[model samples]
Target: MSEVITDVPTEAPSEWARHHAVPTREAYRRTLLDMARLDPRIFCVDSDMGGLEDGFGQELPDQYVNVGIAEANLMGVSAGLAHSGLLPYANTISSFAASRAAEQVKIDVAGNNLPVRIVVTHAGVSAGHYGPTHHALEDIALIRPLPHMTLVVPCDAAETEAAVRATADLPGPLFLRLGRARTPMVNTEPYEFRLGEARLLREGEDVTLVATGPYPVVMALEAADLLARQGRSARVLNMHTIKPLDVAALGRAARETGGLVTVEDHVRIGGLGAAVCEAVAEDHPCPVRRIGVPDAYLDFVAGERSLLEHVGVSPERIAEAACDIVGRRG
Candidate 1:
C-alpha cells in the first residue's frame, strides 16, 4: 500500500487518502459539490450525465441543471451561464462532448473565452466495452487546437480533485478528461499540483517515460520499475496538463535523457504524444517514440484493459519501448 501524503488534511475522508483508490469522476463530483456549497456562482450542468445525482442535484437543486442528452446544447447553455457571470461545470461523455458538440465548444465556449469547465468522463478507451462510438480516441485531437482552451488529463482521483479546485478561478475555457473506472493511485507522497507543470515521478538517466491519463501514468511507473530491474534508468513524468505543454521539463529530458517515450490512451495523431513531439522537435531535438492508439478506429468492442493491451500501452510494451530507445542512443 502507498503511504498517505502529508499535504492532504487529516480530517479528509478516506477517498482523499493517497493509497485509497477511487474513480476520477467521483473525485470531481465530491470536489465540485463542496465548491458549489461555498460559491454561489458555481453551477453543475449535466447532459444526461449522472455525476451530480449524489448531492449537487438533490441537496443543491438550484445550482444543478440537467439538459437531458443534448451535448451541443450542453455547451451552449454552459457558455450562456458563463456569460451571465456563473461558473458552470458541464458534465458529459467525452465522445459526445468532443464530437457532437465540437462546434459549440469551439465557438460558444473557447471563441468567447468563457470560463466554462468541460468535465468529460470516460476519456480515451476507458469506455471501450460500449464500443467505438463511446471511445474518446480523438477528443484531444478535436479540442486541443481550439484557442483559449486549457486541456488537462489528471492521472488519478487525487490529481483530478486538485485539477478541479486549481482551475476554478482559471481564465477562459477548460477541458478536464476523466476515466470511467477506479484506478490505482500514482502519487503516494505529498506533492504540489501546479497547472501546466509536469510532475517528475521518478528519476533516471537512460530514457524518459512521459505519460498522461490514469492508466498511462500507472503503466509508466510500472515500466520504470521493470527497467530498473534490467539496470536501465527510466525517468517517469506525469504530464497531467496537455495543452500548456511543459517545454522546460521536456527540454531537460531531451538534453539529459537523450530520448523520450510518450504514453497515452488517446491516439498518437493529436494527443499527448503529438504534443510532446511538437515541443521537443521545435526546441530540443530528441528521439521521441509515441505509444498510443493508432489512427484507425477500433472496430470491435472489449474491456478497457483488453483494449489497452491490444493497443500496446501496457507496462511490458512501455518498458520494451524504453529499452529500444536506450539501445538506439547507445
Candidate 2:
C-alpha cells in the first residue's frame, strides 16, 4: 500500500526556501469538499470567492450556496442552516468573515452555539501584496472575545487537514484562520491533533516564543538559527488553537523559559499576545513581549514585506525581539 508519509516530496533544502506544500487555507477547503462528497448533509456558503478561487462550488454544487457580496446575510443564512441540523462551512476573506460579520457571527453563530465552521482564507500578512485592506491583522483579536467560539490557526496544510477533521467532531462555532500563501509544514511527526490544544514544535531553556498560524513556522526557524548563533536556545510553541488555550503547556513553558514572546500575524491588542498575558498573569507575573501589527492600519502604500517590516513582525524582527528579551533577563 502506498503510504501517506511516503507521498511527501523528497527534495534538497536551500538556504532560504520554505517547503510549502498546499496553502493551509485551501487545503482546509479541499478537505471539506472531499468530506462533502460522502456527507450529503454538508453545505458550504461562499462570499463570492467560493465559486471563483476556492473551487468548493465545483465539487458540491447542490450543497453550495453563494450569498453574493452581502456578508451579514451570508452569516444569517449559515446560522439558519446550522439550526436546521445541517453542518455549514462559510468561506470568505478573513477581515470580512470575522470583523464585517461580527454581529452575525456573535449572534447567529456564537449566540446560538451552532455548528457553523467559518474558514477564513488569505489571512494576515499573506495578503500583504493585496494591501492592508485585505490584510486581516485584527481578525484573531476580534474573534477571540466572542463566546462559544473555537478560534484556530493551523500552522501548515497537514495540520490544517487535521484541523478540518477535528472540526467535524466538534459541534459549535469554529473560526479557522488560513493564509493565501504556501506555508512550510513543521510537524512531520504524527500526533493526535485536536482543536484548542497547543502543539510544542521546539524545546528550549532560554525563552518561550508562543506563536500561532503560519507565522509560527517562521518563528521556529528564526529561533533555531538564532540559538545556534548565540549558543542559547529559545522554546517555541504553536498555539494553533487559541480559544481553549493549553494553559498546562503554557505554564510549563513559562516556568522553563521565564520570558515569553508571542508572535502573531494579528493585532497587538486582544490577539495571541493578550491571550498569553491573560494566561500567564493569572498567578505568576513574567515579562512578556507581543509581536504583531500595531493599532494603526497600514494605509500607507506598501507591499506585504514592507507592511510586516514596518510593523516589526517580520522573522528578523521576531529574532531581534527574542534576543532583546533574552538579553534583558541576563
* lDDT by residue for model 2 (83-156), tens: 99899888788889878889999999999999999888878877787776788888888898888899988888
TM-score of 1: 0.95
> All candidates' lDDT scores?
0.89, 0.78
Q: What CA root-mean-square deviation does each model show from the true structure?
A: 3.9, 5.4
Please state the error at residue 33 of candidate 1 in Å: 0.2
lDDT tens digits, residue span 1-330, model 1? 112123443346334646668778877787787788889999999886764655578879999999999999999999999999999999999999999999999999999999999999989989888888899999998999999999999998888888888899998999999998778888666567899999999999999999999999989999999999999999999999998989999999999995999999999899999999999999899998899988787988997768998978899999988988999988
Candidate 2, poorest ten consecutive residues by summed lDDT: 9-18
For model 1, give the 10-residue run with minimal summed lDDT: 1-10
For the record, the alpha-carbon RMSD of candidate 1 to the native fold, in angstroms, is: 3.9
Top TM-score prediction, candidate number: 1
